[model samples]
Target: MRAKLLIGRHARLPARLLLLAILLGSGPAGASSQPPRRFEDPLCHVVEWRTPPERIVSLSPSLTEILFAIGCDTTQVVGATRFCNFPPEARDVPRVGGIVDPSLEAVLLRKPDLVLVTRGNPLEFIESLVRLGIPVYGVETRGRLARILATIAEVGAVTGRETHARRLIERLQATLQDVRQRTATLAPERRPRVFFGELEGAHWTAGPGSYVHGLIEAAGGENIGSVAPSAWSPLSLETIIERDPEVYWGTFGEEGEAAARERVLSTLRNAAAWSQTSLGRRPRLFLAHADVLQRPGPRVIELLPELARYLHPELWSRDGQ
Candidate 1:
């Protein structure tokens, strides 16, 4: 049977063994069959079986969102992390555990035919699942807008919905490319120097090798502190004063814009030299939802374009050019 065609059906072990034996008997001696796609990681491999997997479990919230986006049957998603709370429908799925530490007992009890997990899942947990003869599929995608789309396609291909996945990636790439073109119109001199702070207290900023650094550059702004080797690093007021960024971007989970602004300003103003920088005098502040921005998912296509408009109003047209 063509394995690709049977994407999401569940097959029992005994039946699969019987089918394998029959295929071996029918073939000429010493003949070899085509190998199933091997993902290299021991935890996730494509199993050639009598049937495909019907029940699925997702360990990461980001992956869960991607799976649902590819049109997976919600009822078939029997288990998910507690944080996998998007699409409203996910809330109804049984919570297996947190991302890093999942409840193996809960997962085993669900009797999932296929288990989906991302790169950072615990090795021990995956080993245990493997010992039980469970089929697990592991996916690792870099934190970029395109990778998110590729992940959609990858998941779709495995679940026999590659067509749907490809279409989704095409739409997403088009939107991002359009935004990139609009951003490119800005003259280098006109591009403002911007700083993206993850939190107020920590003074953490996204820098080199980070996906957001790419986002900031694509949006036609210079990331003031991205020269650092790490993607995220702590920034002191002295460093802020030295760079003198034109815009200060941050994510906050609080009520009232005035209160939030005051809190942020107070922290910066405490450092006398830093307060004198270009940002403190006339700052263009950008705020985003923490979960949406922090998690590397499909939302960045929607997130970055709006931020570009805010940072470089003159470059973009009245209809968000």
Candidate 2:
């Protein structure tokens, strides 16, 4: 089936213009001889299709979402993991498996022309698919919004839909820029200090390089745990008590309010010192979906306003008193 594209004729111009210019001049014969660079994809390890892939399979939810954004067509996607539930239409696709343990047999049976998976996926599964002569494209997002757009462009090139992909990338960039401008008036002091994670185990929170930390900053909040080197890290209860963030955030919706409360209590219980701190006394905790909070995709824009409201309720007010 053909993919549906919302981007119109104008979006197709840039790539066409470049091709015309290349033809008018002369094509570089040396360009084909260059070895594939680390960051450069359509890499030597993977085989690229001359024609668009009619059947596709996605291993990760984020990749699946990107595919749909490019406009998934019928006969295109035969299988996806249980976690790829964005855009709602993805639910209709067959569920092959989940993270860590993917169903290789199910993937093979679907006979997809191309399979998209990210770096975190199991090496063995990817190797097996490669051995079977299936085109497996591996995307490494590195938890940044820019990388997400880049991946979309790459996928578009691979699937012969570069025009649609370029437009989508530009629109996403413009939206992000607009948000930045809207929040430019914010002062450093106005930025609320926020902590996010589970109370159980090591008390994980997003750090400096994490996409969530970037989102927190973009939404006008300061992530209390953004100092760590890793994207997600474990923090001590004493450290949390010392920092004493103004707002608390976590993934607790599926469990409901009672369960959420229990989870928060478990963390507070572990951090007994936090009880003495002001933030602990009457914690301004909020629950959000794990995917929305974690996935670095289009839903980030939707989450921004929700975060802004929590960070600065005064700015986001009702129409009248």
Give the TM-scores of the predictions, in the order they appear: 0.80, 0.79
lDDT of 1 by residue, 97-182 (tens): 99899999999988998788887789789878877888777777455555677677767766556777887788778877977898
Clashes in model 2: which pairs? none
Off by over 4 Å in 1: 1-44, 47-52, 198-202, 235-237, 254-259, 318-321
**Predicted structure with the largest lDDT when compared to the true one:** 1
Model 2 agreement with the true structure over 1-321: per-residue lDDT tens digits = 011111222235898645544543354532553322111233234434435788999888877777888887545877899988886898888987986788999898889888888877798888888888887877775566566677788777776678888888888777666556656789988887888875557778888877678778887888888766688889775677677777788885567767987778666646776666655777777677777766666666556667766776765564342
* Global local distance difference test of model 1: 0.72
Error of 2 at 47 (Å): 3.5
Error of 2 at 160 (Å): 2.9
Scanning candidate 2 in windows of ten residues, the lowest lDDT window is: 1-10
RMSD of each: 6.9, 7.8
